[model samples]
Target chain A: MKPVYRFDGFIFASLIAGLILTIMPLPDAINAWRPAWPAMLVLYWTLHKPERFGLLGAWLVGIAMDTLTGTLLGQHALALMVIAFINLKLHLRIRVFPKGQQALAILMLVLVYEFLLFWVDGVAGFATSGIARWLPVLSSAALWLPVAALLKGAMVLARRA
Target chain B: MAGLKPTDVLPGRGPALGTRLFLLLACSILLMVLDSREDYLQYIHSKLNIVVYPIQAAVDLPFALADWASTSLASRRQLLAENRDLRRQQLRSDASVQKMIAIEAENARLRALMDTAALMTDRTMVTEIMAIDLNPYRRLLTINKGSSAGAYRGQALVDAFGIVGQISDLGPLSSQVLLISDPEHAVPVEINRNGLRTIAVGTGDAQILNLPFLPNNADIRLGDLLVTSGLGGVFPAGYPVAEVNQIEVNPSQPFAHVEAAPAAELDKVRELLLIWPGDVQDQ
Candidate 1:
């Protein structure tokens, strides 16, 4: 958990919304275009306000994702928590970066999450990585732009209020 | 991306970096073992699914809404046409029922064929599909019937047309069905007309199945209907499974690649039945 001290109902609502969008019916070709929206948003909150949504929150939400999508149990839970933990550790440095560089960092974090997924899946005797499976990471990279912008805007609005 | 920074700060950097990292790594490793070596995690899957059901139900809400909205203005002409169509379908089904009754009567008369030894029939649970897996490579569908409906792993699920697939996972109130067209699934079938047995494997398309290893110039043809042979005993005998669409014989390959279409319409299925054999002896 970070050093933030607020309930932030709006942020939690946005995270739920992101999870809803994650489960929506995306076309097969663009299905991989479905990014790690929930994870990215979770990371943004964990970094910007680490105290509220911490590693435990990430782990629970990840389990919910795996269950909702019927993936192998603990798959997304493990990946999400790892990424969230990393972000928490680098909370100060991540906030200092400019928008463009921050996006790059988010991309790298998502990349690590994807790699962990591939490795964990392989370890369990599941089939090796397929080329199409990586399409989400590319989509996740592109998705960072809007997600970051939304969080940035939300924080601004909160401050003004 | 310019905005005010987060101000509601709480001191969360309690655990050192190394400690959290070690805990995370340890937790993941434990999870991996539980997921792999231990099959009992099915209970965990079921409980978690119950927790996330609202999310799934929410995701499915739009489709349900769309379906509801689509039929609002269904015209009288369409209803009449559908009634006529359903009437004709009912008539066609009645004929099959008559044929089944006749077969039952004949079998009763020929009691010597198989003993009338108290074969208890297993009950069937009707299930509706909640959602289909759009993953082209992995053919899976979430069904409404689950452990609550007495659906178990490896139970056979069939439709009005023929065998669709079997239950792969038994969730709390929902289970995952692996369609016959999935790459990982295979069904034992026989040519209904000739009784030549062969294993039909999923070709990753609901419309196509691959029948491998019939000798060159074997007597299989286009439009030949294949039915379950009951050899593997997983499925009941004499259910339409597929129709041979194309058969290729390559002299150099030493094996004929025969392709067929599954009789069960995976794309259009709304309701399914989880059935077990009546005769436990045969099963």
Candidate 2:
């Protein structure tokens, strides 16, 4: 019999950290390179435990993000919900892939997430900073490997504890 | 396995995936439409802002600590030199303010003679800029003041040098400022040299503002100073806004392509003065 899956404190802690990182101010030189921390964290939770942290969880996190960032209401929520849905459908196949292929898939997912945000901004008449708006997508993809490893280690530690 | 029903082959969750997605999508679209079209969501956003205050403060704590450390660790000699420099600067400004007081009195007397309404002095308060990163696409600042501090929406913000921005979103403990450098922002400005009025709009660059309505034959020169015209009713009159840096008068184009550098260091401002206009009584 499989063990029961529950929403754990570990996931809650990581999500809070992600929220903090998303709004943390950096030096202007590299501000554009700040990764989509919340999006990546949502992706991690959904991919690892879809039954526990599914579309509703992603939507809530996105709502918090929109409120924090002062974007048009529901903008981030919509983008993140779509990302969660895609991961829910493909987690099984993508999880089985090699590390490099998994990273590529994660990159595609982040790109889609950013594209949705861009589309929303365009439709809402919010002018986006040209080229600079796409920088986070690349940074998010590049940091995915290290973030995944760190989260995996933390999960193992939590399980042991 | 033979006895099990075919419908039970895959255990269904609370709701099907597609159904949930569609419901959530519909809800989000409704929210966006409501948010963009009206002010119905402002109250909810302001209330939700209280929940995120702690997160914003946590992110700001490190920077605050570093600033405190630097100030507390400064040597007495450096402090004394800084005090002396400030004293000299204060004396110079005091002399200028004395002259300004005289000029203001004479101007008010002249206005009274002309039977014009008295020019009311704006009430001002200092607010520190919170160290929080807002949307990168828009030039927004989160200041450490909110409705509790009597900061209302659409209040004008200015730095020592010039106008900075206006309050966009207000929470209970903090407010967000939409800088003049945002692409969506526009200010009515008149050239100080000629009083030729035009609207200066932000071009998504912190240093540049575009004046798109100026005719090619408009008597605007490079280095002309732009000041608020008071027509928009948001910003007060005669505050320096920008300085015209470039102008291209192309015969083919009806409107000249002109750009100006903002007078305020919009990207570097750490403290801002919130001004209540003459019409709005300061709380």
Candidate 3:
């Protein structure tokens, strides 16, 4: 590991990959279950590397996502900043938790993120369908371990280099 | 030479979380308000979308590759069958067009006799849909045509059957279309049975539209076809818009509740025609 910390390209590359997956088209039934990949990735990085990835980085990623998805600007940014803050504060405790507990924590955080989105959308007079937006929490929970492992592996490789 | 020191590299604490969250939240609220209420941010949105363009292109690559693979792998028999079907359809359409030419002349003469302005027949550009908005609340799709292809805001989109939607926003290489089935969209339509004019608004369902303001005594009936009335000046006149499927008149309610199925296959149409009105040139 380097003596001094720096912005890791691997983090960004993973974020971009997450961004691509976030916009990837899926069939109708599957689309409703689409995980909030970008937000999830931001959470992972912020939790694992809070010194490097924090609220501002998460905000930028969210804005990029807003642009990619053509949602109202700043909508996703707000939700992601909130998620990042929560993760930053709880990263130590979260890092030591069992996988099942970690998944539960993620589920709660993601639900909060999605609820903020739902509330913002409502306040902005945009209509949303019933219950489908919540479906992603299950998907995000299911994929948390695998995604965490992948990001952990990437980070390990990046540090070694 | 040492073990992975994850916690050592990442300090347990960073900036004051509350203050940063508050500031970011405030900034985001400001952005949301400005973005929703004004058109000024559109310049920024368009410019920022350039950054997003590559992600969209990359995401679409797999689907494109799959399409190419399937087409290449198709048997000669399938290709021949498709070609034969298209040829037959083209010939039938050609015969119809020949008849339409004479009918169009007669229509022009009648309009001239009546001193009414000639109907505006638009020049159309074919565009393929690239992506659909996954948000259930909004009905929108991105099409390959954009300002580069002479697509402009308010340009009408149509499938083979009828009006599909209007161009809501455009980027350099692609444009977003707001479908007629979006709750925010309203089309002025005339009933084909009796020429009764009314506004049909989307009910937030792709398959249905609501004729909300029609009076209880309106002569609309089940299965009556509704066509564009040309009142909006967005959609061209005389294209089929919807078919009346249900009518419910409540004595207590001021207006009848009429529902119609949109004529255009809003959910299934993959290709669209971008219409430029003949009278108004693209700026």
Residue range A48-135, candidate 1, lDDT tens digits: 7676777767877777777666566677778988998889889899889987788888888988887877887677654554686677
Model 1, residue A119: what's the lDDT?
81
Best candidate, TM-score: 2
Spell out the clash pairs found in candidate 2. Answer: none
Q: Which segments of model 1 are wrong by more than 4 Å?
A: A1-8, A152-161, B1-13, B71-73, B107-125, B134-136, B212-219, B231-233, B251-255, B279-283
Clashing pairs for model 3 are none
> Candidate 3: DockQ?
0.56
Which consecutive 10 residues in model 2 chain A have the weakest lDDT in total?
Answer: A1-10
Best by lDDT: 2
Local accuracy of candidate 3 as per-residue lDDT tens digits, A1-161? 56335446677888889988776767877998998897788889888777777888899998987777667889999999998898988999998999999999999999989998998888988776688889988999899999898877766676676
User: What is the C-alpha lDDT profile of model 2 across A51-81, one tens digit per residue?
Assistant: 5688888998888888788788899999999
Per-residue lDDT for A129 in model 2?
A: 50
On DockQ, the stronger of 1 and 2 is 2
Task: List RMSD in Å for every model shown.
Answer: 5.0, 4.2, 3.8
lDDT per residue as tens, model 3, B31-117: 899988868687777777677777777877777788889899999999999999999999999999999988989998999999999
Interface RMSD of candidate 2, in Å, is 3.5
Score each candidate by Cα lDDT.
0.77, 0.86, 0.84
